[model samples]
Target: MVITYIAGPISGNIDINKQAFLNAADQLQSSGRVVLHSASLPVGLTEPQYMDICFAMIRACNEMVMLPGWRQSTGATAEYYYAKKIGVVVRDFNQTLKVSR
Candidate 1:
């Protein structure tokens, strides 16, 4: 399975953006596509634990999807750059066409 790590903005009062990513993950999952999302991170997790969780997710995934508004997030931007540097298949969610469709 090719796990796609979904990276995007998670800060500020952006519940709608957060939900959008979750909805995207749901849609992908419904089609049997493997997708990882940061929203799965527990609220108020310790810094080290958060880093561990994110690293684990990135290591487990074969590729990454920069969710819409990812550019607005500092962490997401850094992850995008890292993914590119490491040769992970990074793509923009808005530009991708669903193969399962």
Candidate 2:
């Protein structure tokens, strides 16, 4: 089974950001992939601390699914580049789901 990390904004409009992550996680799981969702991480940590946690999770995943608005998120953008640097497949959430379906 493939392990996929869900990456997106978590700072602005947190509710919407979390919902987007959950929706993508559900979709990916339904497609038989294991999902590592950052939104599931505990809140209140400093940005650097959160990124540290997220980077560790990303390193464990086989792929990354970047949600809409990811471009606007510093963390998500960093994840994207890190995934690329480490050779983890990076995919658009909508495009990946459509292809899987």
Clashes of each: 0, 0
Model 2: weakest 10-residue lDDT segment is 37-46
Off by over 4 Å in 1: 46-48, 98-100
The candidate scoring highest on lDDT is 2
TM-score of each: 0.84, 0.97
Per-prediction CA RMSD (Å): 1.9, 0.7
What TM-score does prediction 1 earn? 0.84
Per-residue CA lDDT of candidate 2, range 8-85, in tens?
998889998898889889889999999997799888899899989999999999999999999999999999999999
lDDT values for all models: 0.77, 0.91
Candidate 1, position 70, lDDT: 82
